[model samples]
Target chain A: MDGVMNPTTNIISFDLTTTSLRDVNHYLHHQVSPGNHIDIHHPNGAHNLAVGLQEAIAVDIHGHTGYYAAGMNQLASVTIHGNAGAGVAENMMSGRVHVKGFASVSAGASAQGGLLVIDGDAGLRCGISLKGGDIVVGGSVGSFSAFMAQAGHMVICGDAGDALGDSLYEAVLYVRGNIKSLGADAQIEPMTEDDQAIVANLLEQAGFSHNPNDFQRVASARQLYHWNADAKQDY
Target chain B: MCGIVGLLIKNPALRDSLGALTVPMLIGMAERGPDSAGLAVFTQPIAESDRKYSLYSGTTVVDWGQLIQALHQQLGGTAQIHTQGNHGILTANLSPAVVKPWIHEHYPAVHILSTGRTIDLYKDEGQPAAVAERYGFSQLKGTHVVAHTRMATESAVTPAHAHPFTAGEDFCLVHNGSLSNPHSIRRMLEPRGIHFDTDNDTEAACRYLEWRMQEGDDLKSALQKGFEELDGFFTFLMGTQDTLALVRDAFACKPAIVAETDDYVAIASEFRSLAHLPDIDHATLYEPAPEEMYVWTVS
Candidate 1:
């Protein structure tokens, strides 16, 4: 991509209106160094923008992005100034993806490891099937979020919709606001000092000012871990 | 996957550009739905005594003048028709009870797309962009509009199966997800004298909701019943005379986003369709919650 150089900050700016996404992605995938800072202008809800980045460069997308915007993200720090579409950081390996506006369904779905911070609300099934990822939402999450999550942490600073953490496996959820309901095998347990410390660290990383003591922890009850023939099929 | 787009103009000054603003949104979802496309536009209602029917001739050329003349003769009603290609909107001071069966008998080849005091619909089997250009969607002016582009997962890829499905006056619904029990729903409605237009899944939902309204349930309660009875994954956007309502299934598997400003409210299956909207940068953008009825009416 023929990006213009910002002589002062040494930031490279790629205008999507002129440069194709393939060229930009090719450059990001193959040519970026560890310390590079890139600016993408005019995203306009395009899908698969700047995905599969393996370097530690910083990326700032100026507008909204479509599905899988930062999917499979690596060491790069990517931020969208506007909203994000479904599957924003699906299967991310590492690094950070931050959305300044609300995100659509399945944000950070099945992400192995990374920090996905949404300053606004996230839709249904956020972090569904998560595998060792960390998600911090400044606003509420919709129904069936963190369903069957294996391992990770989700910190919700606001309210959560129905089925906060359903059928969870070793994933801890800290919510500072009310949860409409919990999923099967998920229960609200008494928060401990260790949980408070974890919440504090994640909140600090997400740049929030909420007190960790205000959060409640939701985890699996381990009842569904094995089969029970006497209880019929209903949960 | 299918594409659904709806726009309701609250500002009278912006109503004239409803179709102009929605064309890009329909085209934006071309990848999701490329088989067929259609739209229903709700303009100012005509005289209370008059009703209009959107008629499509479907690849067959018919003399619209002679049809209107014959309608005026047999029905003994002063009927006027406006034509664009094979599609026409016929207006008359006639009840749908008398006119619908008469057209069905005389012109069996014609398809009645919609009927209402203010609604006029057009649909065809083609690419969404081509279909939009073919019907002059850019020139349409209305208070609200509901449109769909089809990928044809549950039914045939015909123009009739394309969305903006209507069952009663001044109301239309477009769907993005398939229903699991459309056949069962059809069986439920057929005994009540409600006719089945096509076997498409969305038509079942359209007729069911309208049937609920016909039974004295308001839009919100009708939708509440719909959530209980309709078993499937659906993001339905509907348009009535003066209102636009949107809802997703309980699971919320499908995607929908709304961008609303003081001037207008726009709904689409994705934000890609809404990026080009006027003042979208400042519009309040949010996703509709699962199983919640979000209804907006023009003042």
Candidate 2:
């Protein structure tokens, strides 16, 4: 891929077919100031694209990415025009990672901060071990989503697979469609006005036209917060 | 971590390029599985009376033509050998009951990989690319292919332990995850007089599913029974003479992606392994859901 800078528009375009991933990642890490627009072409399911970005820039990828694309982002907004593999926006301190197509497993795992938006379905463990981040999926999320989540909010515009929000802590989940089954210590509570407002805001950010009122809240029952010997591990 | 790839050409004319397309998919998974590799191809069936046995010489060289001559002289039926590197496929009109023991008694070093009417399998302890080249995989023509690149999470990295494990006629299975209860499954099957070729956990799973099929269960029913019996993580891809099937375990920790077009249905452990497929940009791509059966057949 030809890695070149356009003098007129102030855009840096890197073609993966001609440019090595290391070179493009090197430029993304060491070069470019804030507000720069980067275009990556022909990703072809390559892994670890646009990771560790610490500036307020815009990066757009044109094709499918393998794994861990846009991981550990600080302030950059990255958009993948095609499907993304596992861990699309993991451990982001802050930023926006948008997938135009489906996302594989662990869409936003253990993120301290960021808004991860997926326009299509997400694979298993969508938000497993989440910590202080917001995830909005336009399509369904697979099983074991939000397992042991510590903080942040998740909004699902579609159905959820088995075991949604197992061992959740503080983090709230809003689903607009059916949840096949709930995990241990995870219950569906009534959606309040404040929760609706948060879902509305997250939906707007995610560019989805779904109504926030259709969502239901899923959170921790807090039963497993303390051990009781008589429970015998039954939920 | 291992990688499993399967391709079933929907168009009859594209079957010749089966191995040509599958080689890239296997090589793309090099990082996930580097220690060993195997491929099983379901070619056109010869006839009901004939059986094709895939034999490996295992780090040793032998006169393949002489082996076939010896089989003809001893068994006195139609026998032929197709030699490729250290592997030979012996097609005989005689039953395995007459052929297997004779080969064991005469050619003790030759190990059989699979026995079927339409299957020929090759496996070795080497890099995936090297194994593919060593077996001339690019020239293989078949209705479907089930291949594996193993990371050796269990069992030794030997030719026997390489995946695409076969159990019965025209059937093979490749796995990409570990089985927690393989010993239990083995013990369960062993009392039934089922013999195991390797201690590899995938072998147990392969044998279990094939055993279920042998016990009057259809492929889908056998797979459903497998879901109830096989524990731990897995993303299995299997191939029969005319079918290719894929299934992931509950929890679905191991990744799997399927790209289906009018021409082909490609299954891989990851999307990158399928990126180079024809018309892939426009193919319908989706991850196989957990505990779900996806089966495709040749038309």
Candidate 3:
């Protein structure tokens, strides 16, 4: 709505009700000026919307999206005004992706960078196989979340389903609510003051009104990283 | 991977737009499965004595007029036939029990897709949008609909192998995952005199439920039994005369989303299929739990 004579701030709009997903992605991939603000209307749960974005622009999608929305995002900020399907921000790199509504399974699976924020609940496997990325969920997440998470930080303000983190790696998991169960190699660890501060900052940035001090940290025990002849009895 | 979609309109006002609303949902799932697509729409039932059977001929085109005339003469009942593309829907006042056996005895080439009082099924091998267009789905009138797009994992790519497998009278099912023990299940059912039309695993699952339902189990209990008896990754959308049901396996490997509004209850393999639904933004949306079955019946 703000396409004035600023030259750098151009506004392009794509109405998915009349256009196809291919056309919409093509325009976003090849036909946008740098630093431009793009508006997507009537997304209507279409999958793979605004994926592989490599610009420093801002996109506002005004409706629900299908699977892998904003996937492989790089150096761009994408916002969804409605719910998101599975793999909302899979493999996101830099910048931020925000979902104002709920998200389906594997919200941010195997992301190397970038920030993913879900203002509502995220379904099963919320952040599986996270190479590196910051994930913040305002509400709860489903079972088997953060499975085999490699690095980065994941925060959930609400409850978590069964097996919150299974075979977790170095990623720091912070949950403020109850956990149904912890997965193998995942255990709750004492939170330090620095960890509390980090959680507080992430919550504030994600617009979640919760006390970060109440969060618990879960990390891998690291016993399975290497074989130990002495530990064979425990197996 | 396959895509499944089912919509049950609770509000009568939306009945006329059932086809219009369902086309976008089916087309939205083009990426999940593009091999073949099919749909089953349930309109209002006519007289209790009348039966509706949707037939599919494997060949691209066929002259169904002679067949319909022969079927009417054989059953000695009045029949009305409507042909669309290679699919034909015949509504006759004859019982499916009588019509099915007679057709099979005389015409071994014709495939009876589904027989119900209110259901009409149409499917083909192609893009979902094209398949829907061929059936004129955007203009059909119905209160509930279930559709599928198949990727040909368990069977060959043929119109006969398309989804929405009919289980029994006024019943059909669509699947998104494969069964690991279909051959064994088929073996078990063969001795009991159960018949299978296609080699697809989904047909096995559908026939299993049909057997269970024949033993007097409701749709919910039949699916509950399915959870224990059948083994494999599966998300099933089943439709009966007045009910629409969905069930997912315990592993939840297959994705499913359910959205409910005052007007309708919609289920799809993903949310994108439900996005274009009316007032969906305000509708309560969530994924069905593992090993859980959801059934909605019309009042």
Candidate 4:
């Protein structure tokens, strides 16, 4: 049995296939310091695996993870090799987190910073109230995604959920797949050359295999900010 | 998670005295982050000499009693050190770098989280109000401040995992969402030498903005780039020393409402939170669009 130690600049591996994840996290909580590298192998559907870590550490989850996998993260690199449960990476501040598989509901809800990448499908309310940061989803997103979003950009490679970009302010939505419908005050605009270039650059950065030219763009009408009491009569 | 309240005011006296607002705000959001709470208010930028001394030996970590004694001895009796649970806030002639390293060395078990020019972090394990009272947030004062309450569903419930995280020297972020692909993004940014702390996705969002800002992009442009680059559902709010920015995902799954008038602009996760504000004349409140951002600055 490896005894726990103080925060050190070392590379540690937390393999859950053989041992429990709680023990690993507990052991690492005291021993792992900022600027350390921690690799978690065979997570195997663990819940709330990596919650609050303040150290500048690196964590790689090898297998699928349960709910709230990486919530309230500060400065750390957490990578999930498989799908994530609801509220994955919730309320993250600084650091980078990556998910290679599908994501459940409320993904990146009210996220302040960092870059969140989902290579697979995303569930509901993705990027809701997103103040800042970037979210790149390679697959389709479920319903009510980005509802009442104040800021940030959401890129969808597959179909989008209902009420997409509803009540949005200045964020940009780019979708490569078929959009079921546009949400309130959300309009589909022509992808200009610049828009296409942006999509291409994002695709390249996300390592997406798809062609950027196929994607479309959606944005807020900016009319909601100036609500015309008379305009309501038209509706 | 935890709670944080900070204010920036034009009047130093008012700024220092206006800390009372933090008490209620922290109490209101107590359930959101049931950890510790802290408050900080700065009248102006710290002096260079004070900043220099605060950078090195002055800000060493110590217990509440010891910290108070040291503050009194080193910076005279003007320093204020407030502690609650495992978290606390110290306001004196000190720099963030100095305070952060001291916290790390002495309170290694407690998450130092972040330190900024005008912002100080303190958190433990309880409701926001409890934490606030424990840290003497009721006495804080500033023109503007931000706080958070945590519900630890997505991440671990530790003092370190709190909100109102610092993105840069003058920027702080609060969120209510999750990042879908944090690993790949982490891999992408690691080579760039950006350091990260927690495993949560919010940090990734902060790093992304820092990266964009470092590349000479303004807040708006950097946020736009963030929309196209990052993945997953999210609703976020960011505050700089001078500006406040809000963003929602393309799908717009979560809920965020904005209320604005000629005098002030108010935003909250639920509309009820804003209904009690005083003198909200000619207010127009509505939900933000998906994949959109709303920015407010001092006019």
Candidate 5:
């Protein structure tokens, strides 16, 4: 395998089971360049696999990843063929981070920029404090996701965690699943024409194969900001 | 991770006198970006001729206290120097260029991130509260201000790494997102003489805006170009001498909400941050569209 491998070439392949997690990160950090494409096979729960990279390289992790799999990534297209663990893509700044299987807690937490795609269920705080980025969860997301997102979009295909988009400001939350309840200051609103288009496009991008018309939009009620003595009494 | 708070008002009553609210606004969101904080305030543009004889020459950092002392001596009264973190703003009668050279000579490592007639910067490492207390930000008075709290991820945690980063004379940016193409973009911009202080993606965003604005594009147009050219997920809030703008990527991966009323426009990571504001009743709160921009100018 060593004799056949080439480091400088644009196209790279990784047999995940045979490769060390450290090697993967090192290769991604120092080997691959921008606009490069890579493919992976037989990845089985590699931990801290790809963190803090700044390139346009593409990697397909064939199976699940362990904790903090793609934390703080700058630019790179990572497609996990299976599930991911806690803090997947945490604080990612730019590029695309994709997970084909379920994800653990804090997916995309405090992420400044980038796209995080969870094709299956995601645990807590998906897109939390997301400064700017798009998070497309094809399935459910755990509670307290997007708690204080300053700006960005979060789209869930399945059920959502408790307090979805609580106290949200500047960021938009779109979900197609059943919501147990809205978090503080969150309220359901009519989807505008422009919003519908956005939902449709996002749905297509996430490969959801669902109707955008069926999804309901939720946003901040804007009531907390105006709380007065009278409003306090109602609360 | 970093928390950034910025305010810009178009009302004539709010300009140049915004330091009072600016300090609190930054302190309020101190938890989001708690590593360092800074503030810059700008008055109306000054004539270029008048700047030539000023005490500070070029854009450089000065011994803020000593400079303030000299200005006070020259002006013959107590000059107000408002410090927040490593950055500070002094309202006094002095030339920025003359002060620039002195700062460069004495505090060579102290980067004068940016300089203009109206805008001055102060920043330092530590939590927002610490920086604020050390710099005496509570007493600052200005029409509009921007501050940041930082949790280092892709870059080092230092005073120089703080937010409200200036790209040019009057353009500054606070960002929440990573630029996936920083290496390529950096290579493209560096050869053109654009300097970078940190490896954070926001720096790329700053340089991107600077490059765009330098090509004769207005802030809005430059931001639009950012939306079109820049890649990855980002919700960028940028400020100029007179305008504030917000941008989301094509995918809208980040979170941002804007609540507007007849009297005020409040934006934050969470609705609760703006909860204290009166007159928020039934406000129209909505998120900025992905790949779209919302801009406010103080003209």
Candidate 6:
């Protein structure tokens, strides 16, 4: 009925110790506006914080969060000042999510777009099946990372655990340190000029100072897409 | 999943509010594990030359006065019992070993939560808030406190199934993960005359630590042995007479955080559990690496 609403500059705060998780999520779903800032205190390991948001609002969680915090987001950016539990930012579609401390299992699982950054190490299965988003970890990542990732980019400044990439697809992965093992249909790929540019840009965006040249790229071998009678032994 | 909270106050000035401060921490973790809750408060050692034994009765009603009188007549010593909710702490002028075996023989329905000079343990199958209120957690005065909220993964939801499992005299442990080889370990310990009350895996780990310490191993070495001998994921918070220790499995599948300030050293399964702590903003917070054992002691 009218021109677009002016970008909101209001800051709203929710104290989790006094407010219910349902009320917080309902407020984020209905009251959030573009450019609005939300601060959540005493998150106290509550689950599903700031989930399913599409606005370009910013959420700053002051304490640790439980599973699926900021899961399946669109344009909203979320920052956890403390550690995150399992499935954080799972199936996220767009915008940015940053974890200042460590993350439990499946830190950035199946995100399709935007950047997911962890300042500390991420537990097992990080960035699993990430569709198109970029993930950058300032520290090491646990085993089975980037498993079945279809698209996007991942940069680890520290070591990667066992099976760095398992059955991954078009997504490009770069790690500065050693990988314990590789999953089926995943292998190391030579870094080209374009790969360096992509990793450098992602690292810069994620606020990491790691040099792009130190990273090794990995991708899917593309060998298991179809069944072969002669390759039955491999199966 | 489970929630663990422990606070070891370095400053004696904060001793009086230890229980008040820890009640909120344990209650704050209600969402993590709501099936049951427990707390072990290590109070300042009393001046009296008596032994204190914390006991629990799962039944809704019990005659605590009669039980205490009977215990006094049998053990031939003066006894005083304090009852809170479903638990009681009995102080008697008798050796703990003499009183413990007598309780086990005469009062099989009564569960011995802890027996120590400074620790009083309370636990039951209920919400965290209810359990804390039942045990007067907010009013307890202690030098340190360790608590747990159990979600009932490996054992049935009962008063005896709660955590803060006693490791040895004046030592206890709370665990957050399942043990893969508890049966084998229990078999090994049973032959060594170690008794168990429940089949819960954590009790096995607790008894194992007790056995190791009995064999003259220090707490640090015994926890290191836990990493070598125990399999599966775990993050353990252990409390002794004067120190608190935390250790994680090699894979560290569980989550844990440590925060320390000038007044106290605190550990919790999550940072949220420490948010309400005093001066937490100024506290140094970090996650311990896998297989790394961190200990804090108060003099």
Q: DockQ, in order, for the candidates?
A: 0.80, 0.84, 0.56, 0.06, 0.02, 0.43
What candidate 4 gets wrong by more than 4 Å, as runs, is A1-235, B1-43, B48-61, B64-103, B261-263
Model 5 residue B151 lDDT score? 65
Q: Which runs of model 1 end up more than 4 angstroms from their true locations?
A: none
Better of 3 and 5 by TM-score: 3
**Model 4 docking category:** incorrect
Cα lDDT tens digits for candidate 6, A48-157: 99899889999999888888999998999999998888889999999999999888889889999988999999888899989998899999998889999999999998
Model 3 misplacement above 4 A: A1-36, A228-235, B60-65, B72-80
Quote the positional error of residue A5 for candidate 6 in Å: 13
Interface RMSD, per-candidate values to 1 decimal: 0.9, 0.9, 1.7, 12.9, 15.0, 2.0
Evaluated with lDDT, which candidate comes out highest? 1
lDDT tens per residue, model 3, A1-235: 2212335655677788777889888877887766979888888777799999998989999988888999999998999998888899999987799999899889999989999999999988989999899999999998899999999899999999888779988999999999999998899999999999989888888888788779999999997788777765753
Residue-level lDDT tens digits of model 2 in A58-170? 99999999999999999999999999999999998899999999999999999889999999999888888889999999999998999998899999999998989988888
Candidate 1 clashing pairs, residues 3+ apart or interchain = none
Between candidates 2 and 6, the one scoring higher on DockQ is 2
**lDDT of prediction 1:** 0.94
Candidate 2, residues B31-123: lDDT per residue as tens digits?
889999999999888899999999999878989999988889978998989888789999999898888889889999999899999899999
lDDT tens per residue, model 5, A1-235: 3112456774577775577667777788887778877776644444687788889877777655656777888888888876676678988999889898777668998888888989878866778888888899988877788887878888888988678888888788888989877888888889999888888887777777888777888877776665467654643
The segments of candidate 6 whose C-alpha lies over 4 angstroms from its true place after superposition are A1-20, A31-45, A60-64, A81-83, A100-102, A161-163, A166-170, A177-189, A219-235, B45-50, B60-72
lDDT of 3 by residue, B1-299 (tens): 99999999999988999999999999878888899999999988878999888887766466789888898776788998898757789888898888999878877777899988888999888999999888899998888999998888877999889998997788999999999998888998989988888899999999999889999997788888899988999999999989899898876889899999999999999877887788877899888987888889876
Better candidate number, 3 or 6, judged by TM-score: 3
lDDT of each: 0.94, 0.92, 0.88, 0.66, 0.69, 0.86
Q: Is model 3 an incorrect, acceptable, medium or high docking prediction?
A: medium
Mind giving the per-residue lDDT tens digits that candidate 1 earns over B1-299? 99999999989998889999989999998888999999999999999999999999998899999999899889897899999989999999999999999999999999999999999999999999999999999999999999988899988998889888998899999999999999999999999999988989999999999999999999999999999999999999999999999999988888899999999999999888999898998999888988889999988
The global Cα lDDT (0 to 1) of model 2 is: 0.92
User: TM-score for each prediction?
Assistant: 0.98, 0.98, 0.90, 0.49, 0.51, 0.87
- Model 3 per-residue lDDT at B216: 97
